[model samples]
Target: MDMSRLIETPLHRLAHGRTGDKGNRINISVIAYRAEFFPVIREQVTAERVAELFSHRRPTKVERYELPRLGALNFVIDDVLEGGVNDALNLDGHGKTNAFLVLSIPVWVPETILQLREEITA
Candidate 1:
């Protein structure tokens, strides 16, 4: 696969939000329907790799963790937003910044996984 094209594709942009704080870091929890996708997602979001993927913006920090039981991957990104939850609450009501931050990573998965997620949630 052409990695550059994949990174620049609209799918990636849509999967991940465009507006990132670029100043305050936040923790994002990503749950995959299957364990197989963990490594692929990790490779796409690694600190060094993410910098290149999001070359236009810089992140202060990126930490990855494995949720084996849930078949998930959790990422803690530093400085991806401004002022963290405090600013979000103060400025945007309710005080939740993590939701937007979590939306900023393009989590690639199969259609089956998407269906499974809907099923579980429903």
Candidate 2:
């Protein structure tokens, strides 16, 4: 398939994610719903971009770990919890919903992949 042309697509349409928290840190896992979408996600979802996405929280640092075999990406975001569940006044101390924020980032996908995803979802 020709991959020269790509279309803007929401990451949620290509993958699903879950979040976990530890002290002042949150770890989010983005797993492609289909193996075919993994490449598109991996290429566009950068550590810098993830950091930028959570810029409001002023994360100390953002680290991305690639699990190609599992068709997933793990992001460890530090210092976004406002000082952990025990200390933070925030309702989302655990930050379980942060995964959705990460999944909200848009990425460019080849038309072939987009069509394939649409077919599967439909």
Candidate 3:
């Protein structure tokens, strides 16, 4: 998984949302670690782009946050799940549907990080 290629993939741009904040209409965030990966991550995760990806899901808001010290990017996505925590707990049939929904969306991670993990294991 080359870092450059991975960033360009359609899957990498999935699972994002748009901002509803006044005067700051465009803001987007994708989760990742490592400073080297931020440029590509930031470029692909624009608010407009995110809004398109999650248009069907229709979250209320999306905001980006930098956590350099933790080497992770945090995204605050509002209203992703309907009826919130209580709805989650009252899920039918042992939560398989909810689990499937979560698995359907792709999560982006740096290729360099994957390479490092492979090296460590090898």
lDDT of all predictions, in order shown? 0.47, 0.90, 0.42
Best by lDDT: 2
Per-residue accuracy of model 2 over 1-122 as CA lDDT, tens digit each: 66567899889999999999989999999999889999889989999999999998899999999999999999999999887877888888788888999999999988887777876778
Candidate 3 at residue 102, lDDT?
26
- What candidate 2 gets wrong by more than 4 Å, as runs, is none
**Which candidate number would show the highest TM-score if scored against the true structure?**
2
Regarding lDDT, does 2 or 3 come out ahead?
A: 2
Model 3, residue 74: distance off in Å is 1.2
Alpha-carbon lDDT of model 2: 0.90
Cα deviation in Å at residue 81, candidate 3?
0.6
lDDT tens string, model 1, 19-110?
32333554555554345444455556555544444344356667766666765555656654445545533463222444454446555545
Q: What lDDT is reached at residue 37 by model 1?
A: 46
Which residue pairs show collisions in model 1? 21-81, 24-79, 24-81, 25-79, 89-95
Q: List ranges where model 1 is wrong by over 4 Å.
A: 1-24, 49-58, 88-122
Candidate 2 TM-score to native: 0.93
Task: Give the count of colliding residue pairs in each prediction.
Answer: 5, 0, 0
